[model samples]
Target: MHIAEITAVMKLPSNVRYEYFIKKVTDFEEVWGLFSDAWATSKDEDGNLFIPFFPKKEFAEISAEKEWALYKARSISLDDFIEKWLAGMKKDGIIPSIFPLGNDMAAVSIDVLLKDLEMELENY
Candidate 1:
């Protein structure tokens, strides 16, 4: 499947916010590569670097479940995205860990825009 946009907003324990974007990824592997590259290049406000988790089909599926319309309408919360959608993905082994970035009190928000790639991808 193809995705036009995926946005991940991470609110770290230190109250620092990090936003990651994935655009026009054609498959799960591409998503993994892009996420890895972004994490490798990312630095905190203090210039501390952190590693990123490898993207899996489960991660893509979690992204897919996000309703862009609802998010745009401001009807979703970062806590809901983590407690509901991401928690489900974790059960399915899509996410390696709930707190991959090591933020004890982190919250994640995801927004996804799906592309019609004629692959019968699932959307939630």
Candidate 2:
């Protein structure tokens, strides 16, 4: 069910995908990201490191390309995300790339993602 929904959502624009990412993560209490030797990361023009996350494993899996070719989709619990990952990433100056499809994504600050996730959780 969700797999099909995500497939359709993936075809939409990045902003819509980002909103779905937040909702699905909040609803499922899990986040998916690619991992191999270490978690996959990319740099913006300013050299800011970003770790892309998805609301579905299929989304993460599809993103595995080139440098991420050996990566596998890994799940992170929402509790860990809110309690540990977010703070650690904030301190490390890493941003979250939400629902990245191709080169387009919503790269948001840790604070913003934290707030959005918290707000989404409130709806449940």
Candidate 3:
């Protein structure tokens, strides 16, 4: 199975950093599909989709409040948002690559965020 780790960092209003990590066994296409659906379903008569301010399970790990807000407030198309988001992730080296061929056993340290954000994978 292919595993990807998603880390999101947000600077709250009080300067208290909020960081969350999500790890899942999914690929880029699946991730894209979720966002596409969200955009399509949320589109208004003006063709603008207002994305939620915070990360949700549907959207992949995303950072930067300004960029996200700008996209939503400006009514950027879903295509544009997807391209920009993917490009940014690639530029930052956060885009997960395809799983290695023939790798049956792989392990990754993932933060289990159910109860506490700081919880480690080993403990779970």
Candidate with more favorable, higher TM-score: 1 or 2? 2
The residue pairs that clash in candidate 1, if any, are none
lDDT at 25, model 3: 14
CA lDDT of each candidate? 0.28, 0.90, 0.26
Model 1 lDDT-worst window of ten: 67-76
**What is candidate 1's lDDT per residue for 1-124, written digit by digit as tens?**
2343223333333223211222122232133311311222233466543323223333333422222112111122333433563455445433222223333322232222112211213321
Backbone clash total for model 1 is 0
lDDT against true structure, model 1: 0.28
- Taking every candidate in turn, the Cα RMSD to the unseen true structure, in Å, is 15.3, 1.5, 16.2
Query: Model 3: how far is 42 from its true place, Å?
Result: 26
The list of candidate 3 runs beyond 4 A from truth reads 1-77, 96-124
Residue 12 displacement (Å), model 1: 14
How many residue pairs clash in all the candidates, one count each?
A: 0, 0, 0
Model 2, 85-109: lDDT tens per residue? 9899999989988988878999888
Please list all clashing residue pairs in model 3, or write none if there are none. Answer: none
Strongest candidate by lDDT? 2
Over all chains combined, what TM-score does candidate 3 have?
0.18
lDDT of 3 by residue, 69-105 (tens): 3232113333343456445544543322111111111
Clash number for candidate 3? 0
